[model samples]
Target chain A: MTEGEFKIIFTGPMGAGKTTAITALSDQECVSTDVVNTDLEQCDKALTTAALDYGHIDIPGASGVRLYGTPGQERFRFMWPILASNAAGVIVLLNGQHPDLDEHLSTFVDAFWEGGRMPMVIGVGRLSDDDFFTIDAITEALVERNINPPVLSVDVRRKDDVLLLVEALLCQIEVNELGLAEA
Target chain B: MKQQRLGFVGLGDDTASACLSMLKIMDGRSGISWSLSDPDAADVLMVANESTDETRRWEHTSKPRIVVYHHNEPKPSASHVLQHPFRVMQLLSVLEDVASLLAPTQSQTPLKTDLPPSSIQAGAEAADVGEFWDSLHELLYGDFPAAAHWYVAQSDEGELWLDARSRRFMADPLLLKRMMHHNIRPGVLRACNAPATEGAVACSLFAMSWMITPHLPAGLSSWISADSAFQLLRWPSFGSLAKSRSDLTLCALLTKKALTRDQVLSLSQAAEDDTDRFINACAMSGLMRYDKADLQTLPGVSAEAAGSRFGGLIKGLRSRLGLSA
Candidate 1:
């Protein structure tokens, strides 16, 4: 809400396009630590994001937004809570190629929040492969699990796509007045 | 013409022996360079242990057709071999796959070329050492899934801690039946029948470890741990029930058969540690050979028809437990 008072955390499994999507939208200096993901046994062939990635985005009217990307590996799940502290909101990214989207979402939601309520949850469905899932389908699946949060179909590489997501999330944050009193 | 060569870094006598075994069956066009102690000796680097920090360092250097022959641990970035003797053929098949991909070209493209070369090279005498390292990292790190596959393919056996009896079930199912016919219990049978695949075996072991750990509630968890035996049982053609839940599903299905509590306990007696207690707990939950027979009544089957059903249940249980000797 205030300048440098909060930040959006990009979290998801590896190769879900968190870094590329963040960099595309960021207008200011973006600090990122990206090691080429070396374990492709269970991931996409041409996709990788090894460690943490970071970027700063200046909203057209609101305060500049700082985006932090966490390592997508399950091994780094311990870092989620630490990053969630002093967080503006959370975007749980999905690879779309994953066979069990509902199961994956349940696992992520349970692991990320520990049943504790989290900030506004946004499901960013990165359309990969020819067979794409509609935003309504993804949102409906989330809603079944009581995760009736705003969901979006996004292309992390496009500035307009990221801008639209930022606007949608900001509007939700306004109605809820998230991170305002805390700041 | 000189034969195309492969190098080894941590190639010990054991690996050398295994490679020699493969070499015996392999066609004679390719050559191998053995490294007893030298990390740089081989045209193909073999790291049998990934936990040692040195393996990562080895990744930075050593430009050989790399094959990692180790169990799943931390260090080495590339391939691993299977841990079982039966899987040696499977491992070799995978190696052949990798070798075909990494085989040096006839032209042997130079170490440096135009941007984004499809193939990359590094040298001991090369001046572009920095560029070489970066290129090597990209070349190796970029294709990690392929490398990990090679690693799984090369490892001799996975890390499964089954006792002697359990190991026999895996090595030979008929032997398990023989032991069961002698009245050996299902827990002991399951302990011996852990599957060959690493991921499934690992998950089973993890669940088993929890089930057998000192203080947990015994039934469902314990039976779940011993589920690996069920995975082995599905070799020829699995039924609808077994396919649904692997171990847990099998336990649930067994409950529908309706055996007596004592019969379940008798089967449970063959199990070692908590696996038996777990089965006993399941029997108590009204699954398997255990049905609603009042323990207060006269012991054993009262009717000839009941005896026949019980006899059939024992046979089915024996086969399911890998005890059909």
Candidate 2:
């Protein structure tokens, strides 16, 4: 990875609002691959990101900072590592209300875990105060895998929440750099 | 006695007026007299939940701060807190201790903004901390498991009903919150026969155990077996608990691989005592388990290489994005 060229990847399961989160950060409209949805059982959203979503933040002195959102379905699993490579970090967003949240958490977290080399932040959205899948409960699913990234309760509809995930990912990056330095 | 100047910050008008009235009522007291002043001018501060700005400004200062919150419980941080309409005696007791804390001293640290309320110290908490944890240890891990399945942790705030088998508890959210947000402990645990009652919030023992770490009596010393490796079994939900940013960072590092105490200390670059405290919190919370796996020989990237390469970029991103810790 070039010194100033670091991209942050935003990947999650279906209906987790990756495109919206990317759009929230990207100075321009987030470019996405939206197609008519046939997999209603997987996610009931009318449009699904079929390929990948693309966005960028203009960072000075470097090849711009790119934001990539990988397709949520298993078929596009190939895109995850492609986007993850040379990336500074990844943000794993999940629909807290999804019945398959535990599996989604395990699958995405396992894919991007990186043994802590790359920073990851987990944002669970659409959870109400009374939702059964509280942030702590979601964190427990990762416990079985022994991966301990920051798990935050967030709503991607708000730009601040998206920024929070970005901030958290930065914190993680700072920590990783610090850890590597100390090592 | 020198009158201590107290200040209020981010308080509701009604709450501020009530505090002034309460101060007037205590005018005749012989202990350290307090005079309310602007937060910046006061020797101590009575802060509402908007403690971030004030705390960041005074992070290195030796002033005592009591977070005073009304309505719902404030965010679960702050070492010293007093709920609104606090009883006169409670206020007096807290004032007396805080006054002692403000008295000239080097060995003691004033109430740290980062510590949990349970770890709150006013001058001399070390004396009671051992006894506190000893009773708690006996309650949770006593030799006789069959002796009691339920235990009640009674403190100045309220009781937490514990199921010893599950290492979980049920407690009034308000009451438990006071123990967490106010400068108080869950007190010691005593065996009880009744099950956790209907209304209290059910929580993992880690939720309870992690709060006592900053005040443990032996914090300056090491608890780790020099040669043994440490790895986190799970990350305590910091979002659900009282913790500082460093706590999150440490948890992230440990969950990645088993590291020796020295390695952790070196990597974290935290003071020995601080490192010990984090390890203690993880161990006490049962989040860290004995893992003897020597460092999984991940290619040793010199810490310098990684730091130097990404340092400026991170700084630029944080600055350009206006992100602050």
Candidate number with greatest lDDT: 2
Off by over 4 Å in 2: A36-38, A75-78, A113-118, A128-152, A157-164, A167-183, B1-130, B141-146, B214-229, B260-262, B271-274, B290-307
lDDT by residue (B1-325, candidate 1, tens digit) is: 1333444545566555555544433332123222233455544455544335656567665354444444543444455443422123343344543454456441133222222432232222232222322332233223421111110101012122332211100213332223222322112111112234332211111122222232333333322333221111111111111111123222322221233433333332323434344343233222223223444432333222131212332233224323322
Off by over 4 Å in 1: A1-4, A45-50, A58-63, A112-117, A121-134, A178-183, B1-325
CAPRI verdict on model 2?
A: incorrect
Each candidate's TM vs. the true structure? 0.32, 0.63
- Residue by residue across B1-325, what tens digits does model 2's lDDT show? 4688998877777667656754654554424578988777898887776547754565455678877766467544667778775644446546755775776441133211222223222222233545456555554444533245555656665666766554666777787566565545555555555543646655555666665665676552243465667777756655445555456556766766567777767665656766777776667556776545465643344344454556777667766666654
lDDT of 1 at A118: 45
Residue range with the least summed lDDT across 10 consecutive positions in model 1 chain B: B146-155
What DockQ does each prediction reach against the true complex?
0.01, 0.10
Question: What clash pairs does model 2 have?
Answer: A180-B303, A181-B303
